[model samples]
Target: MSERKYQPTWDSIVTHPTPKWFRDAKFGIYTHWGPYSVPAWGENTTWYSYAMYREADENNNPAYHHHLREYGHPSEHGYTEFLPEFTGEKFDADEWAEIFAGSGAKFAGPCAIHHDGYALWDSKVNHRNSMNFGPGRNFVAEQEKAFRAKGLKFATTFHHAFNWFWFPVWNKEMDCGKPENQGPGKFYPKFHEEHAMPDKEYHEWWLGQTKEIIDQYAPDLIWFDFGVFSLMEKYRKEFMSYYYSKEAEWNKEVIVTFKEIAVGQMLGNKSTQFTFAPGTGIMDYEKGKLNNLTDNMWITDTTIDSRSGWGYVRESGYKSPERLIHNLVDRVSKNGSLLLNVGPRPDGSIPEEAQYCLNEMGKWLE
Candidate 1:
């Protein structure tokens, strides 16, 4: 077996006390909004983006044909091409925040960017952004304004690194894994070639984008989904410095929720170690939810329905309101937070099922 990767030992922020605001306020809101949502409802994710590069002609799921017919192939219409459809006109940030407050959310956050590489805020790094193209509005700033107005903490989740790699199939110009080698999508003229990976240019682009969002929104918390430790040390340091500097300016403390087994020394302990960081917490990915309470505080993020994908899907079935409330009570009793998700449609409207769930949750909170 190959050697294990190095895990950085970077320490958690100890300059200030773990903010009382976040500790008291449990639960938040997160949305997986992007070009994927533009299609409004599909099977969980933009799998076609990666399946186009797979070796086997057959995909793990046979949904590609449906996706192609639904949203033309990459050649004719690249994922980014759908940016025009992501209009948040229907998105009422203040109203959403108010609903969160009513639902007993301590803070509110948006998927600043998802696995689709589209930043919710205006980004100078990549042209594909909510401010400039998708929503054509400063969604992050709007979210911050609305949530802060309600005295709720502000947070942002970054899933850009995953997207940077996830979408390369589009750039690779590979066929739909067909040995016969079909033609490229309309926008992607090249077919059956190596896809371009993010190089130094992409790295610089990511940094610039990250910096822009941080400076513009000044989120009280920045949650990185996966690539935190894999990031270059210099970039990691810079990110930490920027985050700390920003928090200092606001006269507040900021928290970064990270997991162990990442490239760097995990600020938090592994599930085995139970060495969770202070103010920092744990998140039970899809299958795992904390059952037994730990002396440490943690958060469990689960979907309303295990069957439905995280992003909004039209035919999706959601969990009952009772189950959701049960989940919240269970987690809180264990000293954990519940971060619920509402997969908004491409037009920036919450789906009926998600809203229904939230409304039910609101009733329970009241």
Candidate 2:
């Protein structure tokens, strides 16, 4: 309704203020699912694509050797081969929303996109996504409507900022360099190759995908990954400015969560680190906690499978229900919210252990 209230500057943007909903909502849930879930392997299970293509001799790449034995060579069977396994056969969005609501989450949604570069929604900017390749369903859209129907705030997290260096685009021994892989399946940024340092075109596409989600979903929160540094100043400012502006038009109070990074590549000064100017948005901690409570609002996102990966792994060990309930209590005590992550099986079913923990937490909260 009004002209863009936020400008693309730290001073202009920080003044927009954090929304009240976030301060009050002490818990949320978001899922980590993709083609990587198909393998249901690897330590950091979501990193299967990246780790599977590296040399066996490289520092402790079990995925590389496992890939060689299970699927053969990466030259032939790249990540594209795993797409069929992600059928999402049992995926019921309404049920998922119910499960999240049952867990007492105030907000919930999909990770949207990860470092592997697959989009969960029906995306025009990125053709390699679940709607087109794997499940032929808009995962993001489904979660948005279902979660909202259950009276939970909708949110989306994007890790595509790290996608720029996710693949070894210059390596000829793998699919990351092939013409076929360049389209959407595995077309990563050419950062390792030559002079294309910042990769302006790729950066713009990053902005494009964010704009797509903001316009399509109008989420209550946007959680950014640590790769925020790679998006650089201009692109970062542009997207935030647009997101804050669109919030006004939608008449919604929204939140954006970003984390700190001490080092980043492709900088004019390579030593330049990326940290979000405080007061602009929520600061999220990854698998860690603040020593003491402070004035600012924050989020702590940790996996449900405490002894394993972020995405589904065959041998994941989960947290006890009491532990999870205590985790929620602790975060709320310290002026923070807990955003718990769950990795569903390839067939789109949340693991029984995770489901049990969630239900127990729901009962505890009730």
Best by lDDT: 2
Off by over 4 Å in 2: 56-59, 184-196, 264-273
The 10-residue segment with the lowest total lDDT in model 2: 187-196
User: What are the per-residue Cα lDDT tens digits for candidate 2 across 1-366?
Assistant: 137898888888888877888888899999999899988887788999989877867358989988888999988888888899999999999999989999889999999999988999989988878877888999899889999999999999999888767777777778777655575444444435633454777888799999999999999999988777755788888888899988768988998997865554544456655556667888888887887887888889999997658999988789999888888888888898999999999899999999999999999999
lDDT of 1 at 61: 45
lDDT by residue for model 1 over 1-366, one digit each (tens)? 012111222353333344666667677777776666655444565443554333343356445555566655655555555567667778888877877777667777887876656677766666666665555787888889999999888888776665545644444343322333222222222232344544555566566777787788888876666654445555654565556656546777676654434333454543333222333334434424676877766665666654546676667788888888888888788877777777777777777777778877887787
Q: lDDT of candidate 2 vs native? A: 0.85
* Candidate of highest TM-score: 2
Candidate 1 local accuracy as lDDT? 0.62
Looking at candidate 1, what is the lDDT of residue 17?
Answer: 42
What overall lDDT goes with each candidate model? 0.62, 0.85
Provide the clashing-pair count of each candidate structure: 12, 0
